[model samples]
Target: MDCNEYCELLPACADDELGAAESLRLEQHLAQCAACTAELGRLRALRAAVREGTTYHRASPALRARIAAALPAAAVPAAAVPAAAPASRPRWLEWFAWRPAANAGLAALTVASMAFGLTSFMLQDSPQDAMAREVVTSHVRALIADHAIDVVSTDRHTVKPWFNGRLEYAPPVHDMAAEGFPLVGGRLDYLNGQRVAVLVYRRNQHPIDVFVLRGAGSRKAAPDFDSTLTRQGYQITHWQAGGMDYWAVTDASAADLQRFSQAWRMASGGTP
Candidate 1:
């Protein structure tokens, strides 16, 4: 899908109102287009901000009673009215007549509630959430600046050793040209509070960035499985291989990313 088509359906996509097939197509477009991905992110963030910053409160029991009492007797249905009733207005209706202080209090509460909710959401972001945003921003910036790679070499020997004396840990580099993902080059990028290795690869013409960093270890015996996340339209597949955390970011389809991960594991002699 083109950017224009993607933009048209972005609201529905953000609201999860698209059909299965339409949603799939939209995601595919997002994976390959950096600008669209960034736009989607902005849309989602704006939606969240609006939702968090708005609030509606129903009237309290006392307030409800006051308003009900202020209504005119004629406002009630004939069948619901008592026979020979006094023709005075209901007490609740008095609120609208002259209770300025009570009306002002209700308005103030609404504004305060909205402000508090929005402020809390903005201030309560976790470290992991911040890291994910940083990772995505770095990936998008690299593409826009046309500085996706610093060193251009497909040789695993040359790429792996290029990180020498640059990072504390050694990042394994493998060529997966046979699997349709060819090593294109490598570069250095700072992310998640550390300088890391970014190995570049290409599946057809789309670039895939594989970021390598020191692993915090896996919850299981061996990090055999990979975790996938879709942000703004980019697919991020993370795995732990040889005590190094590998995060592969690309506009490639999830299936392609899975295959890339499997091929990488096999090439590195890591678990499937």
Candidate 2:
């Protein structure tokens, strides 16, 4: 394929949507061509900018009313439609059926455009708030799965060893039965696009998920204060200690999460 064809294929390559053979051909072409590579870079940069820089706003009530007024009322269902089409149909519908391949291509392009627009419309959160929201999502997922603690034990040793070999970094597990925040168990979880370990705990019958992951860029010793954020009615507290990042999320109050973080920091020798 020529540079123009490869350039058209750049988006599929970036999205990993191309078949193996087509991807191989495009990769080979990219290796020899600088212009195509630069174009791909620009495309990727634009996508990143759209994802990170977009501020999304919901449609105004007036716009929604206008759209509702313009759309046809619901009448016949698709299942109730005739099997054979009538002789007369919309001119635009016939044009769409002229070339099946071209119509399919247009359909795919329309879907991609919609997906791009929707992604840019997603809520933009600050880094800290984003982390808080992520932990809340993970915590809720664990509860929904009914397997928050895969090992299902109160013993810290059992929970700690369960994470061995499964994770590159061993998360510190402690039984705080005396502190009223007993260790429920430990399970593997994902956060910030990487697999990490989670130590489950219970506070006043509420499940608290303490996600332990390797520290990203920040190496500073964990600060004394553990900032708390509430998202979707879940309280999240994040801190760094022992070269590891910790996120404790629960439906409990922010004060309860704060207390849990303190108890955790002290138990793990993370307290400064």
Candidate 3:
């Protein structure tokens, strides 16, 4: 591929979105073209700067409820459904009455499209990807449900002991306030078919969940022991240390999560 084609791929490369063959081709090009390599570096630096400098906000429950209430169909929430006529008809019934033929066709098309999309997801989503997705979902659910921490404390002494009898294994917990990720609390969570220990930490306003799964070495390992997983705009850092698997999930930038992961491993006496 020419430099222009390769240049167009810089963003995807930085985002880790390119497929294997495409990434291989891009890597080969980057090995030879100094200009493209420099450009890619600049692009990555810019992306990092933007993420570092920007602040993201999660929608409140009120706002989310309002938004959901305004949708016509769950499949196509953005679709504009015109107001139906008639003096006294419930909105739900009116939705069906309005443009019956067109709406039916749209619904059928939406169902077919969704089926194809689901099939694609099933084909592409490996066990590791599914685990990442579950981690992200659990993180989001904890925040929304306000059950992030069962034992709320910054001291490792108190938080570490709280999980003594709650889980099958003792998860190593440490207070890392000095390292910038202060221990917020710990919670018992169900994941991967067993109860796992979750250590909640905070970097500024972002909550980082360090999910510790015991006996991870027995499971099929990923291609890389240390890797980044992103789903639904959240970043997950998976690392194996001291025979325990750690999956750190957060809404913060990948750099921040990486730093937190490093500090956590150092404090937990587990070298990744």
Candidate 4:
């Protein structure tokens, strides 16, 4: 199904109300569509937040005992009192009567939490914020999945050729081995609704992924196509070369990422 059709089923998918066949199709489409995948991620996160907010913790045994002790003596029958109760009749019966109301209060608190969390999350989701969130999530997923490199090689020739038919545009790959950001490998990734090349590199134990995609060339005739920013503690640098957009994301320092972007632009014969 197309994006619009898949989006229409997103709420159902989030609620697990879709049929098996339709769910399968949606999953297949999500594999290729980054936009839809990001949307699904948002939905799942929302559901998780709501679940977390609504979760209730039962009253502790100590608190229950204290409440029982504070009630009037005649309110509880002798059989209801525990061995530790005072000489007077314990009001365990009153405590039992109030238990349901306490539970109901907790339930109301959970609902309020869910509503507040949902509103807070929705308020922060501007287009730019969502894109940055997606970028950080993609970085985290790569680490968790342990599939950082699809074609592990230090050679640029080997890595660049791997994306020949997999993507519509050829991503320029460079071997920065001598420069300390060695080419570790490359992988095909979905970003911004298209399959792109993600060149992997490393500095010590830090891994950097450079996502490449087709972009409308620099908005001006001048070659001012380099920018850098940090999101979720990861440094990201964006530059355009040969009509393709490049974004390098890493835990490396800003200076290191900037150096890598400059080196990449030089290798691609683009302005720094």
Question: What TM-score does model 2 achieve against the real structure?
Answer: 0.54
Query: What are the per-residue Cα lDDT tens digits for candidate 4 across 17-58?
Result: 999999999989976766777778779876776766543445
Poorest 10 consecutive residues of model 2 by lDDT?
A: 217-226
- Put the candidates in lDDT order, highest first: 1, 3, 4, 2
Q: What TM-score, over all chains together, does every model reach?
A: 0.59, 0.54, 0.54, 0.58
Residues 1-272 of candidate 3: C-alpha lDDT, one tens digit per residue: 68888889989998889999999999898766645655565466556655565443444556544544544533323345445633454556645443434544555566567765665454454667757756776677677658899999989899988988887788998777888888989998766656789999999999999988875632633443354777779988787767788888998898889888888777767563
Evaluate model 1: give its lDDT: 0.74
Model 1 error, position 49 (Å): 3.8
In angstroms, give how far residue 7 of model 2 lies from its true place. Answer: 21
Query: Model 3 — which ten-residue stretch has the worst lDDT?
Result: 73-82
Quality of model 2 by C-alpha lDDT: 0.71
Candidate 3 Cα misplacement greater than 4 A, ranges: 1-124, 216-227, 270-272
lDDT of 1 by residue, 124-174 (tens): 545444445556777887887687998899888988888899888888898
* Candidate 1 weakest lDDT stretch, 10 residues: 217-226
Indicate the residue-level lDDT of 210 in model 4: 85
lDDT of each: 0.74, 0.71, 0.73, 0.72
Q: Give each model's clash number.
A: 10, 0, 0, 0
Q: Residue 225's C-alpha lDDT in candidate 1?
A: 38
